[model samples]
Target: MQCSQDIAAPSEVGAYLLEHLPQATLITLDTTGHCPHLSAPLETLAAMETFLAKE
Candidate 1:
């Protein structure tokens, strides 16, 4: 979910998350909003699959 986009400058939100939530693995998708699976299904699925495959 793109729940965090509500914060200022959604495009740069990843930076904030990375700095504050250091343990979290944040991935930013361009031109997407809350419920990216619906807004950007292909990109979202690809990113999820790639993350899952990582060792």
Candidate 2:
């Protein structure tokens, strides 16, 4: 799942998933809104590309 910046808000447990799921890559996109897919599609795509390229 693509986690946007809002997930970084205080008390957001979803952000902790990255630490919990070390096996799965956690792609955190710095976005201004709640939906990265909508607010920053190009940036989000670039971030996804970078994430996918990681081992």
Q: Identify the candidate with maximal TM-score.
A: 1
Per-residue lDDT over 4-52 for candidate 2, one digit per residue giving the tens place of the 0 to 100 score: 5474453245557656877866565666666777888898889878878
Model 1: colliding residue pairs: none
How well does candidate 2 match the true structure in TM-score terms?
0.60
Residue 5's lDDT within candidate 2 is 46
Regions more than 4 Å wrong, model 2: 1-14
lDDT of 1 at 30: 67
Model 1: per-residue Cα lDDT over 1-55, one tens digit each: 2434534346456666677885767777664466778778888898899888984
TM-score of each: 0.61, 0.60
> What TM value does model 1 have?
0.61
Evaluated against the true structure, the overall lDDT of model 2 is: 0.66
**Model 1, global lDDT:** 0.66
- Candidate 1 — which residues are off by over 4 angstroms? 1-9
